[model samples]
Target: MSKRKPQPPPKTFSVRPKRSLRHTLPFGLLLILILAAFSFTSYESYASLYDADYVGVEVCADCHTIMYDRWKDSPHANMTHQPSPETVVGDFNDSSWMLPPEGQLLPYDDELPAMRTFTEGADFYMALRRPGTADFTSFKIAYVIGYQYRQTYLTLEEGGSLAPPPPAMVYRTARVLPLLEPPREQHPHSRRFVGANDHPQFGVEPVLCPVPHHQLRHSGP
Candidate 1:
């Protein structure tokens, strides 16, 4: 019997640990998802501060009909808008006045040539005299802010040579602000203007106007 050449010692076999594709794939996907979410949130936060960039209320009305209907006529809805016959509440017809320069608040004075404000055709205009000289310049009203307790009209800061009229041409500078309360009764000797009056328009003045408190609640993230 030819002794079968000692069958080479049963060939030794070795097994090595293998990495799981399932475990690695899911972890990589989770990392990618987290990165995408972070990028989107950061961009949204940066775009909200610009007022001119604000998507007008009309854009928001599509999905929120009921709320939009309620807000359409609400004071907050009219907070700021272009000047128009329908939107203007002031009695421009019978109430044109030569208002004192923006800073000279209160009782219409007789000392200087007051600034004249009234409606002309379709637009409102203010005839303002240049300080020291007699150059009367007329400015058109551009925007109106607030309508409930007070309605303040604003002129553009630098739309033209008449812009930034005098003191400063800041966005909120008031061209005219109608008083909510009727004129106060005048007393002899103590000549104080009755009712509400236009305050000074400042370039960097800090003025706080009233807004509906509930409107803030409606704003969502």
Candidate 2:
């Protein structure tokens, strides 16, 4: 045989690394962190329902039907409403009322009293002249207070202030609020000297006027 070049010895490959935790440690830690994050997120999501204690007024209707029926129509039910055609009972079709709508209209700088101006188109507004200001500022009526006897308006103002009342003549330094008034009447009578116990109009009800709560619950009254 021709002197063949000596073949290089067969090269040997290194054995595969052992299947140990060291190689997969990073992946295991990542998986554990992901699981922990999911658990914490789930816990936080489910723990948020403890905010309000009452279920709602609807739930109370089940056991207190009479109370619900009476309450549903009472003035208390109409205590607050949004100012709209459905709730507002005032005349707002370019109608004007004197500033002291209860009294005579006074002469303002523009010959129109600083007291009154409002219009109703798509919305209602109170165009009133602030005491010191020369011009009138238009305030948008945001809410209606009641609908039983009469309705009053709440206006939104700058800086989220609650209007107290329409400035009759002067605006108070305190926070403003909605202008509302209950219908009131007073009849003056001659004063007569009388004993304390002789108070006729000041009738007193016994300490327990209405029946006890438990009795009311059992009986329909």
Candidate 3:
């Protein structure tokens, strides 16, 4: 008897599922690695820009050897120094000069000139009359600037420091010297007379390079 041919084995079929992104890759782990790389690079870049402290040239030497080499022997590097026998070139031998009063040239009339004295001893000093007072205050020599032509002296400010440029910078050459809190020297070419400037701005314009490393020049001698 044919017995329905054993029901033809129930006609079964097998199907294979398609692979997806989550199955082929460690999707979460891959995403985490990408984010970590990005964060590490970003942190390094930003951290270097905002740190505003003088870490010194040696600190930068390792990373920027070329720049450090160019700057180390530059005039800016040797521009300023603590006063010593070797650094000071001025004739600070108790020398005295009868400078013009405040902001005028050598008095052709009845004005008494300001008196400046340079003394050298255990410690060098520059004695000059302070403004609004009749007494002369002796300020110790704190620093010396470069000597391309002449040496300039810098004394300590009110707090015994060279910061904020207290009547410090005594330029070596000038016709008139104002013994003011901030001296305004004049270099008027006219030998006959040089009047006091209403808006005096002949010398350094109150700008100071307190930072050891002044702005560097990348090109040109």
Candidate 4:
């Protein structure tokens, strides 16, 4: 007996069948979960409403008592208030000044004639004669705060309507401002009669309206 050939171990069929649903289900579910997560994050990132309705500053004041109190006392809070007698500095009396002589006609060929001499003792005066006629005049007064070399004055005319000055006699200047300056460019100085012909048309033009209380909206960085 050829050392009884060791009976070869019965061929044990151990081939592992390919895992179908078991392997694919988890991978498919994981891919789907990842896709959903990415979609949710993307939607949150880009979707936002800009320029939404605001609650207003008064509402904010309710929570910030101290800050609101300080803001209330600031000049911004009193910007549009009526000027009381105590706060007003100009002479309220009906002071008048003449722009040109009674019969003198301004030369239309040249620029409108400016006031040669204003009436003495008048609290208010006219800087330039009216457009066509010297007899028809407007009132002007020097500004208390002069910047840009241009005096800001209250014009008698408002958008082509003739409105008289307030009884308080609050007025501004009508001086042309400089547009360009030496080395550092400066605005033109205020002039009585600024026109298109003027170098920069500073005061004559309507571009330089001053905004005093614009900073009120800015709280901080």
Q: Each model's C-alpha lDDT?
A: 0.48, 0.47, 0.49, 0.38
Task: Enumerate residue pairs that collide in model 3.
Answer: none
Per-residue lDDT tens digits for candidate 2, residues 1-221, read 78989999999999987878887999999999999998887764333453334255556689999987787777656555566677666655554433344433334543455544355576767676554455777777765555655454555545443342333111122112222232212111111112212211111211211111111011121
- Model 1 spans > 4 angstroms off: 1-9, 14-56, 59-63, 93-95, 98-113, 119-122, 130-134, 159-221
The candidate maximizing TM-score is: 2
- The true-structure Cα RMSD of candidate 2 reads 19.3
Identify the leading candidate in terms of lDDT. Answer: 3
TM-score: model 3 vs. ground truth: 0.39
- Model 1, 88-161: lDDT tens digits are 66555533345446545544344455455568788976566654454667767776555554464455543221
Clashing pairs for predicted structure model 1, backbone only? 184-194, 184-195
Whole-model alpha-carbon lDDT for candidate 4: 0.38
In the range 122-212, model 4's lDDT, one tens digit per residue, is 3444443444654534455432222222223333233332221222122233222212234322222221221212222122223323322
User: What is the TM-score of each predicted model, taking all chains together?
Assistant: 0.42, 0.44, 0.39, 0.28
Model 1 alpha-carbon miss at residue 81, Å: 1.2
